[model samples]
Target: MLVSAAMLLTLGGCVTMSGDYNVTAVDANGQPIKMVMTSHGSAIYSSRNAFCSNFPKATVTIRDFHTGEELKSESPYHCR
Candidate 1:
């Protein structure tokens, strides 16, 4: 039981809890234009405005930190 408990604790510590998401903006040629870190979808808009001002036509994609899943995608000009 003690060994099981110790293993559980060790495994729990290894689990990552980071919720930060990566917001990447790429140009029409699929070249990276900008990158931002945010925790949620709503935050992406503000981050987009800040990081992607010079690349207004860029395609923006939000990805999960751990799973690398594409959570959202939109154009910088279309973001609110």
Candidate 2:
């Protein structure tokens, strides 16, 4: 049973996307909020002016390591 559980845990970890990268959203007050996103592969580390509120929105960009192009991005909502 222990071995099975361990195997399940390992498999779960493998199925999960890379969580090493993250994006943050700031509100009008400049408060930080965490975002959940799968890596889409982009070179941009950050994007601004994404928010439509009084404050600007920021996104953490990722790129495919091999192609050096956009992979994915995480945009945390602000004033929502």
Candidate 3:
């Protein structure tokens, strides 16, 4: 029983799970302007001056890289 407990503890360290999302902003030319990886939804943003200045009508997309699912998308944001 002691050996089993030790094995369980060792195995626990190998168990890893991540729920990270990839946020990307692209210009009208389909060029990636900015990208970020985060675990929280609130960390994503749609507006960026550097990206939007070059491509005023840029698109921002967020996807769950782990699950291969798109979480959100926005376009035609106002940029200064």
Badly placed stretches (over 4 Å) of model 2 are 15-24, 31-80
Deviation (Å) of 17 in candidate 2 = 3.5
**lDDT, candidate 1, 1-80, per-residue tens:** 99999999999766333455777777766687645666564665676676557665567777786788876434334322
- Candidate 3 lDDT over 1-80, as tens digits, reads 99999999999776333346665577776777755435454444422344555567766666776885876343234343
Best lDDT among the predictions, by candidate number: 1
The clash tally of candidate 1 reads: 0
lDDT of each: 0.63, 0.41, 0.56
Better of 2 and 3 by lDDT: 3
Poorest 10 consecutive residues by lDDT, candidate 1: 71-80
Q: Give candidates' CA RMSD values in order.
A: 11.3, 9.6, 12.4
What lDDT score is found at residue 69 in candidate 2? 54
Using TM-score, rank the candidates from best to worst: 1, 3, 2
Q: Best candidate, TM-score-wise?
A: 1
Question: Model 3 scores what on Cα lDDT?
Answer: 0.56
| Each model's backbone clash number | 0, 11, 0
